[model samples]
Target: MQEFISYKNIQIAFTAEGKGKTIVLLHGFLESSSIWKHLTLELKKTHRVVTIDLLGHGNTEKLGYIHSMETMAEVVHAVLFHLKIKKFSLIGHSMGGYVALAFAEKFPQQLEKLILLNSSPVADSEERKQNRDRAKRLVKQNKKAFISMAIKNLFTDENRNALRPKINTLVEEATQIPEENIIAAIEGLKNRKDRTKVLQQYKGEKVIISGKNDPVVPFQEIKEIAEQAHSNFIAFEDGHMSYLENREELGEKLITLFS
Candidate 1:
């Protein structure tokens, strides 16, 4: 059922479905709980799946023009705390992965496992920071173009044509995000800290999934980060949108990871 919790005085939105050990899913930037439709439909058959719409996106209220990952993590904690959930595994996609890392750092006792999907624990490199700056400008200059290009680039050349419909839907959804919120999310990501140490010290399982041709999060770099964290790195033939483009295969692996 859909529910809400007042965190920082904003009604944070989330959903809990099915029953069994809990698996919390956090969506990437410009996405919301709806992005997990396919995965949840399958996984909820065996596990109680929880999906959250993090700050600045979806149905959740915007925290501000500068949402730190730390703050987002705490907001997540608030939602789970309200539900009285004691323990769960986390699966985070892109920006959501950043929040998961922060949560793991602050509340390791509640986390059973951590999965980074098309995301990294390292802070933005100089070039990426520059790109985030450019993205901020692009959003102000031409919102539609910015949203279109961002979603289109998440898919690789090999499958863009096949996934045009899905890309179009994402573009439409992203276009609705307040331009300021987009910039805030970008800044939040750009200023995030490197949390690989959390993985290195974690006693639980750590899994990292990356797209071979993802333009945003490079695969080679992700493999090295996973190594430093002592995580099991899984590579997808697709790009950053593997969660959508390769749902069947990724879902099977995620089931195993949660198990």
Candidate 2:
């Protein structure tokens, strides 16, 4: 079932399924809670899976203002608190991973375990900072064109070519995002603080899942995060969206890790 909850003065949309150990799933940039539909269905058989559309994504309200990692973490906390869930495992991908780290820093006592999928703890590098600025400008100039460019960067060449239709659908959905939301997200990305220290500080049951061929968050970075956090690392054959591309395998890994 799906519901809306107030957080940071915005109404956030979330979907929950099944009934057992609670697990919260967070999506990456330009994606929504719908991205987890398949995985949620599979995991629901044994667990209560909750997937949320972060502020400014999907049906969630956009504040028309930029957000900080701290603010985003508070939003997640509010969602969980509203559900009366004191402790649960967290699964986050890409940008979602950054939020997860912030949450850990603020509310470590509430987390049972942390799973980062195709994500890293490092903040924006100089080049990435520049790219984010460029994206913000491009979005202001032409949102549709910018979204098309983003789609290319997300998928592998093979998927881009073979799954053009699917890719286009996602891009179209992204293009439909409110201009305020896109701008807010870009600003958030550009201003996000480095969390390497937080990663190093955390000493918990953690798992880092990476895609062997991901260009966004490379294998080396994943290795560094695992080593720094003293956490376990798992690799999938696919690229950035490994959880979606390798749902069954990824699902199995998650089930085992949280079992």
Candidate 3:
């Protein structure tokens, strides 16, 4: 069932399903918990799954101020605490993965396992930082235009054409995000610090799921991260949104990882 939980005076929307080990799914930036709907249905047959809309996304109430991943992590922690869930496995994608790492650093004891999908522990590179700054400026000037560009960047050219309707839906949704929230998210991302050390500090079961054709998080980068942390790495024959591109296979892999 889906419900709302109060945290930091904001109403966080979350959905819980199934009956076994608890697994929390966190979505990427500009996306909502709805992105995990299919995965959650498959997981529910054996595991209890919880998916949440991060602050400023989806149905969740957004605070006026911007928040870093650390603050976002605390919000997730609060939701888990309220549910009386002492420990759970966490699956995060992109921005969500960053938050998962930050959360693990702050409260490692509360996590059973950590899975990162198309994500990185390192901070934004100089180019990415400059890109974000450019995006922020564009958002101020033309929000809709910036969101459209984001959609193109998110999906591969082939996927964009094949799944035009679906891709457009996502882009439309993102375009609707409050301009203030967009600014806040961009600011938070730009200012984010490198958490590579956080990965080294974690000593639990860790899985790094990457997309073979992911233009955003590229295979080489994933390889470097896995090598550095000595974590398990899996590659999908797709792009950044591998979970969506290879749902059934990814779901099966997740079942095994949590088993």
Candidate 4:
């Protein structure tokens, strides 16, 4: 059943399906637990899957203007704590990966496996931070237009045409996000620190999935993270949305990852 939990006086949404070892799925920026529909259908066949809508996104509510990664991580921890789910695997997409890293740092023993999907542990550089400022400005100026364009740009040139319908759905969801929450999440992401050391010192199995043409994350940096963390890494020729660009391949990799 879909449920809500009170975290820091704000409500966070999550749902659980299937049975056996739990696998938590966290969506990226402008995403909700709904993004896991396709992947969860396959994954739940072998494992219990839980999808969470992070603070300031989806059905969740914002605690304040600043939704820091650490605060988001605490929210995750609280939800799991309430569920009595002491141990489970965690997989995050894009911004979700930042939250996952924060979770790992706070509760190292809780994860059986940690996967970063189209995400990295490095903090934003000066250039990216400046870009984030621009994004926030764009959000304020024209939220709908900015979201539509951003979603379209997430895919590779070749996939863009074929994925038009899906892009519209994503844009619709993104547009539903309140202007304040959008700004909060962007600021939190920009302020997030370098967490590479967390990966380096992590004991559980770690995996990194990257998109070669990802506009936000660099493939080379992802490769370096994998090398440093001594983790398995997968790179696709697609862009930021590898999950959509290569569902079959990414699904297979996730199956192997959970097993």
Number of the predicted model whose lDDT against the real structure is largest: 4
Per-model TM-score, in order, reads 0.97, 0.95, 0.95, 0.98
Candidate numbers sorted by TM-score from highest down: 4, 1, 3, 2
* lDDT (Cα) of model 4: 0.91
Which pairs of residues collide in model 2?
Answer: none
Which ranges in model 3 have alpha carbons more than 4 Å from their true place?
none
Candidate 2 Cα errors over 4 Å, as ranges: none
| lDDT of each candidate versus the true structure | 0.88, 0.83, 0.85, 0.91
Candidate 4 lDDT by residue in tens digits, 49-143: 99999988999998788789999899989888988999999999999999999999999899999999999999999999999999999999999
Residue 94, candidate 2: how far off, in angstroms?
0.5
Model 1, 201-242: lDDT tens digits are 877888999988888787898899888878998998888987
Q: What TM-score does structure 4 among the candidates reach?
A: 0.98
| CA shift of 234, model 4, Å | 1.2
Cα-based lDDT at residue 228, candidate 1: 83
lDDT for 178 (candidate 3):
83
For model 3, state the Cα shift of residue 218 in Å: 2.8
Instruction: Report clash pairs, candidate 3.
Output: none
Residue ranges of candidate 1 with Cα displaced over 4 Å: none
Residue runs of model 4 more than 4 Å from their true location after superposition: none
Least well predicted 10-residue stretch by lDDT in candidate 4 = 1-10
